[model samples]
Target: MAEQTLKEKTAKGLFWGSINGGIQQILNVVFGIFLARLLSPGDYGLIGMLGIFMGVATVLQDSGFSTALINRKGIKHEDYNSVFWFSFSVGLICYVILFFCAPLIADFFGHPELTNLSRVLFLWFLIGSTSIAHSAMMTKKLMVKERTKIEVSAMIASGIVGVVLAYKGYAYWGIAIQTVTNAFVGAVLRWYYVKWRPTFTFALRPLKEMCSFGVKILFTSIFAQINANIFAVLLGRFYKEDQVGYYTQGNKWMNMGYTFIWGMIGNVSLPVLSEVALDVKRQRQVFRKMLRFVSFISFPAMFGLALVAPELIVIGVSDKWLPCVPVMQLLCIWGAVTPINNLYIHVLLSQGKSNIYLYNTIALGVVQLLVVVSMLSLGIYYMVLAFVVVNVLWIFIWHYFVNKYVEISILDVAKDILSFCLISLIVLCITYFVTKLIFNIYMLFIAKVLLATFLYTFVMYLSGSVTFKESFTFLLKRK
Candidate 1:
């Protein structure tokens, strides 16, 4: 097989990554709409409550070794072998500990049902640990086409199972089973594609060497997971299950939106950037282009989500989910900028600056947690508002490190993305005003999305946006 040029590989990766992300989210929206209507808010809350435990356990199981493998130079079979065994062991340990502590977890949330649910739901991590090495190998090699196909297949299979179980009145169990199924299928596919088998060799030397880099990533991932799931914990403990449900629903939609843009960036950026990690000039060029492309999609997609939140919630899942509208709106703003933070983090990671990533994540996580907790008296709205503020501003912190390491200035990033951000917001505002008077929810949602998209594209075309033009040209060239 011939080695692909970097540009060809990146273009192909982005193409498939976009398809994978776009279709996956569409499936999520379909499955989510059905499940949200079929199940109650309390059902989502039950699952959401277990998020923190599952999230933290997932971090421990991976033990940061997949990332260690990605960033390591001349990675050997021993590295993959050591990580697979280590992750498998950690998975077993974490599950056992969580299984025993399920009662305590239920007790903490004051929900007896969670005792059983926690044990069942935590199995995804165990299933997932078996695939870390395989997944990392594909990621390291930039096998986006294979990865994308596996993801789409898993999503369809899991979506059908989830919807069937939910429709059959299994409630949260349906959701839990869907998650496990996705993990199980994805792991199987990864193993089938990678064809890399672990030997009977168990060596502490490779594990120890990787751990030196992996430990910081492990800490960072733990804190990052905690930061993400803290709301579930707080709401589950301090508020009603329904409140947690509302937040979960809103967050789920917001994640789908951001993950769409990130899908293209995440799969390609790290591996591609790692190839040129030592070439500051080339890396900066690639990084800026990625920033512009992400900004082009993110700002409009997220802000447009905020615009149609009310209509999307009411029409998509019925009025039962209306309460999540405001929460979703607030989160959309936060989601808009998240990919930028993610891109910079990968740049740092590709350069082996894991310590910087760790420090920034911890500081941001602690401060955000403190702020959100402090605003508890003001309710979920204020908590979400505070979250948006901190997350949007934290880009500066991420950029500070990027500038230090890669010499990509804050001004450089802003210059690349700010125009798209401003233009997207302008388009959204115009679409909102134009569609505000529409009385029908269905028409209003469709019109707002269509008009905003058309206007954003038309404006970008008129302005001859380089990224916009490059995208179309690339698509045509690909055909």
Candidate 2:
């Protein structure tokens, strides 16, 4: 019964989180469509170059304290207070370090402008630190419903601020301003929504324990970011900023394909799984349900997007951005594999298995870092191809890890994947014929997407992936 309650709560949280994340993602898509038109790809590339340093600096600020906070049980107000101070202090330290080392960071990326760009962007860490406590506290309390709403509102507000500023020609600062404003708004709103306050004091002893766990997690975070941000780093150093912009645009839309799925899984699943850590039967039920929900939608979206990447980018972004088309397709395929991989991370954390996660992450991170570095010699096309290869490896490693924890069969995973790919094929066929008949890139893109979406949903309904009555009833009342 307690397990069931946790599932229901998780569902509620995911429903709300998805709504919030969905709105925010849509705004991002809208902005990318607009910003891609307004700014040169070189503009995006410059920011992308600095982003590598920024990513490392930001990770240093939190170092897994937040993740450790979530995994640690029975945390008190004092613990929270200590965490707040520790994270804040780390932010200050990181800011100082980044400020001092800005020139070196610029040198690493081989771009002189990266120094000032990085120094200005380093302020984000400070801004980000303010809200870590509030945000983590929300996760600790499984307050996803409130978390989602506040974040969504901040997202919309930030998008508005960014677009207006970009149009005014602040260049990269336009993007930076939006980021800073979004953090400020999100922190204020998250605190307002949660109403938890901390005096900025640290308990020397408990702070040590929190830092111990957090430091390990911090390494994990850095490893993960290194792999994810490599493209931007490599693009900036080797390719033109315009090319970086193309990649950025491609990456943006590719990520959009996963937002709702991520919403339902990562945002909601951890707290849900954590709440019932001891109950294997119930944990499995919740995990499976979450997996099913994510897979159904995410699978088809990425598949269809891959087929139409060329058309989608050409229409949404100008001809200048068309270089992203193939990279987009490669990344869209990468996107499809994430739902299952992400589920493993959440389940591991919930079961007090973060050490396993840390180990797996380290191994994978080393491999990816080397892989990405090796590919830098091969140019951007193969660099994108490296992503596809790494994704395949990731799926294998995750399954290898999960084998001990759950009984998920290879066949089961394959069945879900194959079905999704098949549906994608059906959609592609429809789009191909319709595209041939119509011949307008705009219509082909939109028509293919809509037709794919409709056909996938229809086929899923007919195949009992979900039922009409069940889905409608589920939607009608948020059951």
| Cα lDDT computed for each candidate against the true fold | 0.91, 0.75
Candidate 1 lDDT score relative to the true structure: 0.91
Q: Alpha carbon lDDT of residue 463, candidate 2? A: 78
In model 2, the clashing pairs are none
Residues 280-395, candidate 1: write the lDDT tens digits. Answer: 88889889988998999899999999998998898889998999999999999999999999999999998899999999999999999999999999999999999889999999
Error of 2 at 438 (Å): 2.1
**Predicted candidate 2 versus true structure: per-residue lDDT over 80-181, tens digit per residue:** 787777778888888898898988877776778778877777787788887787788888777877877787777788878888888999887777777777
Alpha-carbon deviation at 77 in model 1, angstroms: 1.4
| Candidate 2 Cα deviation (angstroms), residue 86 | 0.8
After superposition, candidate 2 runs with Cα above 4 Å error: 208-212, 415-417, 467-471
Query: Model 1, residue 54: displacement in angstroms?
Result: 0.7
TM-score of 1: 0.98
